[model samples]
Target: MAKVSISLDAELVVEVMVLAGIGSPQDAIEAVVRDYVVRGHRTEARTELKDRNLREVDAKPQEPQG
Candidate 1:
């Protein structure tokens, strides 16, 4: 894994640390980043499925009943 540095709000960092029960900001940030990446990839795959002809099958409009 490549190392990268990012600046985060102190308050936000504290909040994440508390919620994650982690001692370091790095773990919280990595967990959040990994979740974000996974979600993004899932969304992108869904879009590709739509692009690949998953047509919406709308029910034919029924004629007014006599």
Candidate 2:
């Protein structure tokens, strides 16, 4: 992927790094952004499937095997 640089507050970056448990600032920001994108995709998929006629499965527990 292409790379670019931007300035951010040191305090904010530190906060994100700690919250994400990543020692590197770049990796921490990248991880958070990637997760946000994934969540957006998931939300879009759920909304699109909301009106679809999908089959539901009911799972039942089986007796324990000896």
Candidate 3:
């Protein structure tokens, strides 16, 4: 684990600690970052699937073989 030194809004830190039910500021921030990263990955995957489906729909259909 890496140690980071950052300055955050004092009140916001207190709020995150309460909202996240975490005892430390570091834990709260880590939790929030993790959630954000996960959401971004999910969104990227959904977009790729949507684009692929659209391409498939736009392609010409082939005739059936006898």
Candidate 4:
């Protein structure tokens, strides 16, 4: 797996460590990244569904000619 470097505030780091009981800052950061990725995927899926629904509505057939 690839590695990433991110900067965090001192207070935030302490809070994460206290809340999660994680041994290292990296573990807490990884957890946050995983959650972010999962939420992003969900948002993308919702956006795609909305777009598809709009297209279906636009493609609906009109009334038959007299």
Clashes counted in candidate 4 amount to: 0
Per-model RMSD to reference: 4.9, 10.3, 4.7, 2.7
Ranking by TM-score: 3, 2, 4, 1
The segments of candidate 2 whose C-alpha lies over 4 angstroms from its true place after superposition are 53-66
Q: Please write out the lDDT profile of model 4 over residues 1-66, one tens digit for every residue.
A: 887777889889978877878869888867877889999999999999999999999899988899
What's the TM-score of every candidate structure?
A: 0.68, 0.75, 0.79, 0.73
Report lDDT (CA) for all predictions.
0.84, 0.87, 0.93, 0.87
- C-alpha RMSD between model 1 and the true structure: 4.9
The residue pairs in collision within model 3 are: none
TM-score result, candidate 2: 0.75
Off by over 4 Å in 4: 64-66
What are the per-residue Cα lDDT tens digits for candidate 3 across 1-66? Answer: 878799999999999999999999989988988999999999999999999999998796978889
Candidate 1 vs candidate 2, TM-score winner: 2
Ranking of predictions according to lDDT: 3, 4, 2, 1
Largest lDDT belongs to which candidate?
3
**RMSD from true fold, candidate 4:** 2.7
lDDT per residue for candidate 2 within 1-66, as digits (tens), equals: 899899999999999999999999999999999999999999989977764534322244557899
